[model samples]
Target: MDELLDRTAEAAPQDLTDGAELRGSSFDFLTGPGIDLAAKAQAFHAWAQTRVAHGVFPYAKRLGGRPGATAELTLLDGRCHAGLNFSSQEYLSLARHPKVCAAAQAAMERYGVHSAGSTALAGNVEEATALEAELGELLRMPEVLLFPTGWAAGFGAIKGLVRETDHVVIDQLAHNCLHEGARASTPNIHLHRHLDADHVERLLKRVRQRDPHNGILVVTEGCFSMDADSPDLKRLQALAREHGALLMVDVAHDLGCLGPGGGGQLELQRMLGQVDLVMGSFSKTFASNGGFVASHDRAIKEYLRFYAAPNTFSNALSPVQVAIVRACLAIVRSSEGGERRERLMRAIQALRGALTEQGLTVLGHPSPIVPVMLGPDALARVASREMAQAGLLANLVEYPAVSLNSARLRMQVMADHTPALAQTAAHIVADALQRARALAGATH
Candidate 1:
């Protein structure tokens, strides 16, 4: 491995020459005299083309027209279709809710749309400040800092917290954002087996034995997005405390639907107070576009507010989004809100039970996110396409995103979906799987 790394490093500069022809070919098309912007553009285009050729190109198309499933999503050849939307992170289906929409409209009327500049450069909108304070109070944290996106939150937090000598311990199946953030910020990062508290403990012991002075940060997801499985947060938190390590929980998937008041897996396990840092995305449950990091320590929040690139460089959350999120939080905390939670849970249970009864290997517990383990990438893709044809939009997970051999159909159950709808979708998936298996056998 050392020799390979050395050789790769040696060849890094020379690798750029392989695309020299493509780079030079585009230079004449540019009218700019300075800045060598044409070279950068050519390199970017070359990389994009390579990704497309590899069948890994993402978001190459746009969704046009409406707000719901009938919207002309880019992948469906721009046709307006009403398939069940399983790919969206809008967990609560609050995006089109009348109350949420009305709140956003009201905010627009009162404060206009955009914040006009970065939050630090100009005083952030009052609505944004209120939302942050509300979130901090709801989460039982001292303070909270918001970012433009979840990626920014992850990146900025890791960059702000860790130093060169510090080490980060993360789950092997952690999100790309966390992995990238840790990699860019710290040199010593150890990825432990997914959801294995024992493995994390052992790694921490080894790191401490090697360098007792090394600052350690353990990272894991509250609920994994792909498998929909939650970690043993109580055990992990205990282990982190025992080892004098800080624990950071990424509650992106679980925050809206999991805990007593929708606080998340950590809160469900009574470990929220023990957790050192909690990060989440508002785009999912809040049905808004932004992310936040909460901590009991005010100093950490202040440090990230000033030092984190996401907080300083990016534009603050729109006033309209902030207002909508505040309204959503109010609804989520209301006494009547339990009905929506219960309804969604029942829908998830019905769908999961139906899929399991059909003899499909459903991953995780009966959570809102249900994944049917369809082996091989080709079969998963075929199943997804077939389900779309059958009036359901299930996502096909494959290489790089998940284990190459463990492709599956990732389906999310919404509160609006009735028991009948969930069962119908499950049957469609089962039928598609059987047909796919038969076709493969015949071809073989």
Candidate 2:
């Protein structure tokens, strides 16, 4: 069965071109009949090698400097391309902010590089402690706990609070770390339809009828990373409360990037101090690498600090990282933050309008992420290569990252992106897609 599927997965040998790859999804090599894990990796690696040779493999391209409207990208072959970059997730364009950089330098001088030890031991710096307090204040859920990375925070929040017997009712399109944490900790995970609060309520009701006593964590996100859509948080929270469940919203992609105060979806939905649990990563808009969980109960914060493996076993965030976020938080809460948010929305609208003008389908709301649908895996791959050649950088997300054959270019918008830049990016995207469609059609 696997062999039969493989035959139709990639582009036919006769259809090969110099800059075009053998089209296939990550799902193709994800599973196989093998006891050794290396066997599966080998199969995937063999396939990926073909993509690299054709210069169409989109992942893991190194950035020469901080990501901005115009940035440099280094491919695996050591070839460098500088162009209008819509790849990196620097929403507020704060990664290289003068103040952010200054804070990092000062912290480095005082504490040196690396946290040196796990927080469970001796790595809790005063900055991290202070940052926790600041985040707590912003969220209005005065109890907070921190983790080294955003992934760690999401995973830890789940692994720490919920027991194996507890139920995890999550959105089907929630982030991978959230899903993985749920799978690792519990067997009774119920995935509701994407962004459907009604579906979640149905699952919650069903779970309560069967296991009313066990804890239920209704997991979701603020601004889903791929689709850029948001759940009705107010409704979801109310439903969770009615059914005796706790709602945990991962705001990794939204916090520090949305709202007038940069409080993200929680603030937009007027849920700042109301939700049961709010967790988010600073990497997206806060210009650093850290994440935190904000809750109303101080006891939950302390409980997670000791119980969460990602928190207890892993090292705390470095002083430099802590300082960067502190500075960014200040910027995110100021009038300047509001101005940047306005500018960001303008860029998003401009890009969306331009893409739409070119007959492309732009998904979701006017968020930092702009997902332009391309439809087929082959077209997406070919278009990605064409975009690179044309000096435009945007991510082509196909199966495994998205649904099968529902490929799209997930462009990350920056606050500093000008209207001119957006228009130029749209033209490049349209031209590339048109060429890809023409080429693919010819091959068929």
Candidate 3:
């Protein structure tokens, strides 16, 4: 609709080569030495506006209605089609559950659509209070704090609790919110190789050696979204204890989808109570848009409530969101939750096996998230486009999201997706990969 294929200018002669040809108009904006911020953004927008015609960018097709394992999607050319979806994070498929929907509708009738103000002022409804208590009980923590969004929770946790004198050590593959929070928390930041607890201990040791009394915080995810792998929480917790550093785990991807009672990866490893802090999102598993930070220490919880920017400034979760999350949480704690998780795992394994049987290199261990290693930016984009055209919708991750040469299709399997559906999607992806390889000049 907004000039999808119009390039801002003609390509330079030298820019018509291999890697150079793939460089969009942002090359000058990103790499040029003396360009002003405004000019760079304008140039990038001009380039991005034309990418729809190139069959890349604006990755997700517009959904005409409710999204599920299979849904109707509208392409850029206004062609509507039904597609098997592997791009959603609704692992339990609770978003569309009748009970959850009913709870939300009832809450909307009682409390309206908006929270009205920040929790610090007038936004702390009865539903919010009840949800917080439930989460606290679930985590076996003394205190729990909520935020409007998971991103805000992570950002606020580090910024609110860690001082300028603190040293932060985070997993290299931690989510962007954690990275941003660490950057804002302190200048003394260290990164450890993903899932490498030894590296984390070494960083912690180095920090302790340098600043004997400075507080140290270690952050990692329970399940990484891109790789679909989880660290050994027991080992990480031991490292933190030996180094006298606090460990914080973000269980956004694993909680409510793994372990007994859906306690998350940490609970599966028997390190739930040992970790100093736990934060997670309700959006992924609980089918609601909110986040919580829980800890055994009441002081930290109070401090966050008083100082966290989100708690202090952002509006709290609406009653409807809280109600749906509460309903989903109940389901996650029920026997049906286990059955759904089993289905989710079966779907993941089925798809993984299918992709591998097709001679595609699938990355990571058995998890709801699966990534097919496509390699190179161009190949990944082409494969994604072809796959979309073939009626399978998956997410393509390239440079910036991942390494330049490690571009991939990040596929997520939901409980509602049948094994047959997964296998069919895999076939489509395999066919798309072949086309993409031939297009990118790869043979075999």
How well is each residue in 285-339 modelled by candidate 3, as lDDT tens digits? 8888999999998888878987999878888888899999999988988899989
Supply every candidate's count of residue pairs whose N, Cα or C atoms clash at under 3 angstroms: 0, 0, 0
Q: Give the TM-score of each candidate.
A: 0.85, 0.95, 0.91
User: Which candidate has the top score in lDDT?
Assistant: 2
lDDT, candidate 1, 340-394, per-residue tens: 6677788788889899999999998766688889887555644554455455656
If ranked by lDDT, best first, what sequence of candidates would result? Answer: 2, 3, 1
CA RMSD per model (angstroms): 10.7, 6.2, 5.0
Query: On TM-score, who's better, 2 or 3?
Result: 2
- After TM-score superposition, the amount by which residue 357's alpha carbon in candidate 2 deviates from its true location, in angstroms, is 1.1
Worst 10 residues of 1 by lDDT: 7-16
Per-residue lDDT tens digits for candidate 2, residues 1-444, read 122222221322224463336466678887899589789898888778778776667788888777888777766655566688899899999988899899999999999997857777888999888999998888998999889898999999999988999999999999998999899899999999999888998999999999978999999999999999999999999999999999999998888778989889999999999899999998889888888988999899988988989999999999999999999999988998899999998999999999999999999988999999988887888888778767788888988889988899999999999988899999999999999888777766
Residue 357, model 3, lDDT: 93
Per-model CA lDDT versus the true structure: 0.73, 0.87, 0.81
